[model samples]
Target: MIGILAAAALQADAPVEWTALQQDNIQVAELAYDVGIALAVICRDDQLMVAITGLPDPAPGAKFRKLEVNIPGAELQASTWRIQGKATISLAPAVYARRLRTADHLTVRAPAEEGEPARRYELALPSDHLALDQTLEACDVPLVLETDLTYDPTISAVTWATSPRITPPNRLPPGGYAEVVLECTVGARGRPENCRAIREQPANSGFARSALLSIRTGRLGLIDGGPPPVGGVFRTRLTINVVN
Candidate 1:
């Protein structure tokens, strides 16, 4: 992790300017740049974040209040905040890793108010896969492995606020059993977000939906000690076994 932190620090100091837009286009948005580590490593807490500096504050009641980001294999939305004269978007670590690994370009669209036109900006990705790999490894970051996640007692102890109710779908035959797996990020506050099904035994079963709902609404207990949970990957497995 120290190596990753160092690399990220270097990147932060001299980020590559990826793209810039005219003031008229984005209401003072200047440029989108890349710091070597796609996800910003918060050295103080070892949390992962993605920040895009240089955007104007949004108007009240804007249609696209959140920023829309798209890469080759993923489409993500992030909430923005005005800090130090720039608009910034924070991305989940898991999401950032998934998209940045193979993405060649990043496209971002800003939300517009009732009468304002939406602005779009695109950024080219750096072509250093080896460095990126090392960076990810140094951070001990896991690849987006949906079905292969092992249970982490520390994460589970704090995150498992309530037991998820897994109901066997009516579509299943007698004595049927299925396994559902989900991948999610637990923030510093221990709240889960970006929950999605990594694997479901039976296609079209409601198990995945139920699991997602439970994760989102469940309360997370506070975690103490090393690194804030921000962007920490959490996976849960639910096996529904029907009785005769």
Candidate 2:
């Protein structure tokens, strides 16, 4: 029985103290709350609390606060890995205005009518938190941290890349080689929204462009709840035989 107890104690996960983000006298454009830099974040038994170094009155020009939390992925019962938590933040207009912008990019396109400044289509977060729990199971640790920043919905461009590839036409002269890279942007919906070729290789440009298009069409498995604030890319070199 003692062995079981010892093992249980060993198996118990320790709370993660993300001390790296602690700071002081910081200016918050979102919330009326003033926060100093030094911060003390404690997590234990599925509970979390953050104590900032300073809390001042809302600045005249400033309206809200951006509460930044870094969530870390962990190993569950067996091969299963997951992350779970709850965040109760103050989201008044003054406090949330700045925080929302911090969430993702808010673009303003030309309005349908003449007098309108523009139209806004804000990114949507998943309504299902349970789904988010499942998707995080297979994602890397960095992904969890990245997702936390996305919750605010005020973020802009989220980006990640893969390796490069090389493909050559079989009919090429004796000496022939090709290598190129394709970069793309994933929209808030967890799919490649845009793509661009970075390297210049005339022979492989066409092929690269096609491959980039394929990537743009591909979908990324996301937390069922919503799209993250950032995008991810898979880059690699490919060798395709050219038919001459």
Best lDDT among the predictions, by candidate number: 1
* Model 2 per-residue lDDT tens digits across residues 74-185: 1111111111121122221222222232333222121233343333222222232332232222222121233232232222222324322333333443334343455555
Off by over 4 Å in 1: 1-44, 59-65, 72-87, 129-135, 143-244
Query: How does each model score on lDDT?
Result: 0.48, 0.31
**What's the TM-score of every candidate structure?**
0.42, 0.23
Clashes of each: 0, 42
Q: Note each model's CA RMSD in angstroms.
A: 13.2, 18.7
- Candidate 2 lDDT score at position 231: 65
> How well is each residue in 46-145 modelled by candidate 1, as lDDT tens digits?
3443455434456543322356666323454433322222324342444444455567776767667557787766666655544444334544566556
- Please list the residue runs of candidate 2 whose C-alpha ends up more than 4 Å from where it truly belongs after superposition: 1-179, 200-205, 221-244
